[model samples]
Target: MAETRVKSFVLRFLLAQPLTYWKLLKYIDVDIPTVQKTLKNLLRNKILEYKNNLFYLTSKGREEAKDLGISVFNSAMCPECHGKTVTLSPFKWLVKEFESLTFERPKAISEYDQGYVDSTDTVARVIFMYQLGDIEGKNIILLGDDDLTSLALLASGFPKQVTVLEIDQRILNFIEKKAALKGWNNLEVIRYDVREPLPDQFKGKYDVFLTDPVETIGGLRLFLSRCVEALKGEGSIGYFGLTHLEASRQKWWNIQKDILEMGFTITDIVRGFHTYLLERDDILNLELKVVKEAPVEIKIPEVDFYTSNLFRIYAVNSPQPLVRGKVDWQRELYYDQEAYVTCP
Candidate 1:
């Protein structure tokens, strides 16, 4: 059943033009392993062909697409906003400063599953939080700082305090050095892992929390449980990113159920709200199934095709954490069968 749906989606999308593996991953709403398997099946069946580092329909595939009634349509996104519904025009100055400050930022490493959104998207996230009254004078905590959202929040001159809890020593040192150079006394970086219990000082101390959690069910639960433990109480807010490339609809349903169980009422979910700028070098270094199994040698992607939906949830009641004191979940926390991009 899942294979049928993925085949239909791939055939319809390829009806318009040839696409690279990265573009297919961006457009398809299935898990990475599923997409890779489906593509291999299609090629074996002579329904698709690979050439010039792109995948397109074969003659038989076009006949199948016609039988499936697939038709091309124009995109309906706002050109100015790129479908984000918000722009950085209001904070152009901050965008320039953020660019300079992050010019020498550390490159993303696949070991920690680290990738960051574009500079505009980073500031746009800050703008969105500010509009929601979650920025100015709010005590906010970021479970991880690979995106350097902490810097954007501090640069906005909002937020009474911003704290970062990260496992990567490189990220911790980078953020701390930046904070000191800018004299951002309100910023704090803590070298902490998520598998452990939430620190006593941070529990119930923040008005808002943000994290881009790993997409596995266990990963999501652990990350959000920590965020829940950090909130001040009812009315506190949290933000995070979820992507279809890694998580399927069934997984999304389970995640939504977990959020409700944790006493969070989802306020808004903006689809494709964040676009990640994955470095080419970083991607080439990883062991991606799609690249390894492609019929033709896949070229490194030139476009920023990876994206995620941004979700905002409010703590309507006292937050309940599913995992209080963590048991050992080393590889399970980061890797699962659905995890195609993450290294084991």
Candidate 2:
């Protein structure tokens, strides 16, 4: 049943244009292994062909797409906002400053499953938070700081306090050094592993929480649970990024269910709102399984295609976390069947 849906999706997507593995992976809502298997089956049946590092439907595939009621058409999004549903024009200076400040920042390491959105996206996030009245004079807590969103928030000088809880020592050091250099008295950086108990000092101590969590059931629950622990009470807000590339519809349903159980009501979700910046070197070094097991040798990606939807949820009542105390998830926290990009 799932395989049939993936096949139909791939066929219809190809009707738009030929796409590379990276592009297909970015747009597909299924798991990596399933996608790879579908591609193999399509090729075996001569419904798809690989050429010049791009995959497109064959003659039979086109007929199959016609049978599936697929049509060729072009869809356009707001070019100015790039479908983020927010404009970055107002935050141009902030984006420039953020780019300079983070130019020499630490590189993303796979050990912590770390990656960050583009500098413009970072500032755009701040703009969105500000528009929502969650920024000015509000206590903000970031469950993870790989994106260095704390820096952008501090640069804006809107938040009363910004606290970063990260397990990465390098990130902690980088944020701490910059905060001291700029004399950001209200900014705090703490070395925290999410598996540990929520620190008493941080519990119920924030007005807003932000995180780009690992996209596994256990990881999502753990990350959001910790964020929920930080919120002061009802009306406190939370923002996080979720990706279709890593999470399927079923997984999304599970996550939404978990969020409701935590006493938070999801207010908004902007698809493709966050885009990660990955250099050629970053991709080559990450050792992704899709690249390793490609039917054809995958070329270096020419664009930043990895993206996620930004979710904004607010506590309707006193938030109730699903997990508490010290519980180690070990490999389960970082790698799952759907985690194709994560190194196993």
Candidate 3:
């Protein structure tokens, strides 16, 4: 469904204008058969309506076209659709992915999301992987993300192999079926506990690694140590740090200092924020820590939003442009790949 991101554009275009199938076929560079088939499916589902050889959305379809994801878009900025209204989706929406979990009917999506907690630190850690030195075709091991494990793997568009290490057999078994449902091929899930230790086959065998192990300060260092041990000589690592549980930000700072001691250089430390919160929380100010002494530059293009919240980290084990000085992705901060000396 996510193939090429073409569907969204196609659907949105068609909904905005009522044109005949033939006209649309010739106007859009898409396959006629594909467009026709999609039209039929959407029409049948009342997602669209057509008459007089021209297409138009039914009332239900019109409502569906108005859907948007929760983001930092300021309604005030968009003079067209701006309002502080809440009604558990008092109006029905055409899109339905959040399903029983969309929180449309919750106390406050933004606030509840802010107040609601993620038991596992899955999404946070995966976002950190992109900032690592070219995560492309790298092997990944996610300890326990449940459904989130798969989404993160695909979103990266990199990583040669992603091994989901889980503690529960039932969840691990369930992931197989879930992967099939999603039609993802490059991801694999492993049932294992971080408490034991990474197996011999995993030692020093990966380029980059990430994990959102069960949160508890007592065992966190141990979990991170295993992640670092798995990386190559200069490989980097990233993970989520849930700050709500603790009053002190020492865990985040101490870990950065300790990781550098072990040899991994620290780069970007993106802050974490609520995807959907119960009330208005400053998304920008949410980023409460120094995520990076300098930005990390990878061969791939990237987008990072979590750098706007409570302290979380994305540190690396190598020395180069990261330690020498400030980083600018479009321009080199240093010439030598091995040293972080200031560039002319």
Candidate 4:
């Protein structure tokens, strides 16, 4: 089953671009040895040609892909920026429309657990959610709203109700004030922490839940478990952001396994989907611009490297057993060696 899945994925991906082994490794979820064997099989079958360490589909492979009803060549490829991960190709129009939306940026405070993507990314996310049939009249709950996603959903006149469960009072206040200013009575904000049990009023009340959780294993588990508690039974959808930078393949493997064990199956992983805005007082922003000369003269790279992949998971059944009792909130969330950034 895994081999068949890998074969179909490779055939579909080759229609997008010629792939190097390393690039394929980054994107595919399978083990390297398995990928090697699959590549060998395709090569032996005269389906692929590997040159300069990059893999390309042969004529036979293209014909096979066509027979399977997959488009072998794309005429709409962007000539200037010709890659999936970096270029905002299919989403460019939506992102441009999102540029006009406005929201207050949350202050970077680890204590309040406040870190957010900008309005553009939030709109991009909202658009994706809408595309997935989560539009107007469905009940949606936001596990956290540092990004003010509830406001975005409300502004679009979609969703029957937008409930937010947040630990930060500032965010709660801001969302309420903005929602009122827009005269959107459907938006609701509640102060709640994932470390504690989900409120009775919220349990099994939502059609969907959206979050961008802390990448720590415990943190993610706690956050998502709460989402499951809030979600309605089977077919309820969940959306969250997970990054390759902070979570290694091993961590991703473990997280995905845990999610499936809890009855949600991953449906889509849109790569490089979340882009963060740099703020003036952002710690990394300040560090990036500073020129340091001590044992070495070093300057930060002139590029925005911060991003997260959008993961959409579907509930296969009512959420599995809930993690009873309050989680230890003081647990070391960022101490893991796989943590990409240092945090207090």
What digit string (tens of lDDT, one per residue) describes model 4 on residues 53-130? 467899999898888887643445445433222334455654544443443445656444355675566776887787
- Model 1, global lDDT: 0.86
RMSD to the hidden true structure, all candidates: 1.9, 1.9, 20.9, 9.4
- As a whole number from 0 to 100, the lDDT of residue 156 in candidate 1 is 89
lDDT of 3 at 46: 81
Candidate 3 residues 1-344, lDDT tens each?
Answer: 42122244445556657655433433343322344456556667786666665666666665655663212212232232111111223222211322322223223222111232231223333433443444577776655544344444554456777667666675566556555666768777777655565777766666555554322333345556666666665544554433322212344465556556656655544333322221223322233111111111111111212211222333444422112112232212111121111111
Give each model's whole-structure lDDT: 0.86, 0.87, 0.42, 0.70
The Cα error of candidate 4 at residue 252, in Å, is: 0.4
TM-score of every model?
A: 0.93, 0.93, 0.44, 0.69
* Deviation (Å) of 205 in candidate 2: 1.2
Clashing pairs in 1: none
- Please provide, for model 1 over 219-308, each residue's C-alpha lDDT reduced to its tens digit, 9 standing for 90 to 100: 999999999999999999999999887787889999999999999999999888889887776666677654565545778887777789
**Residue 328, candidate 4: how far off, in angstroms?**
1.9
lDDT, candidate 4, equals: 0.70
Pairs of residues at least 3 apart in sequence or in different chains that clash in candidate 2: none
lDDT of 3 at 341: 13
Query: What is the Cα-based TM-score of model 4?
Result: 0.69
User: By lDDT, is 1 or 2 better?
Assistant: 2
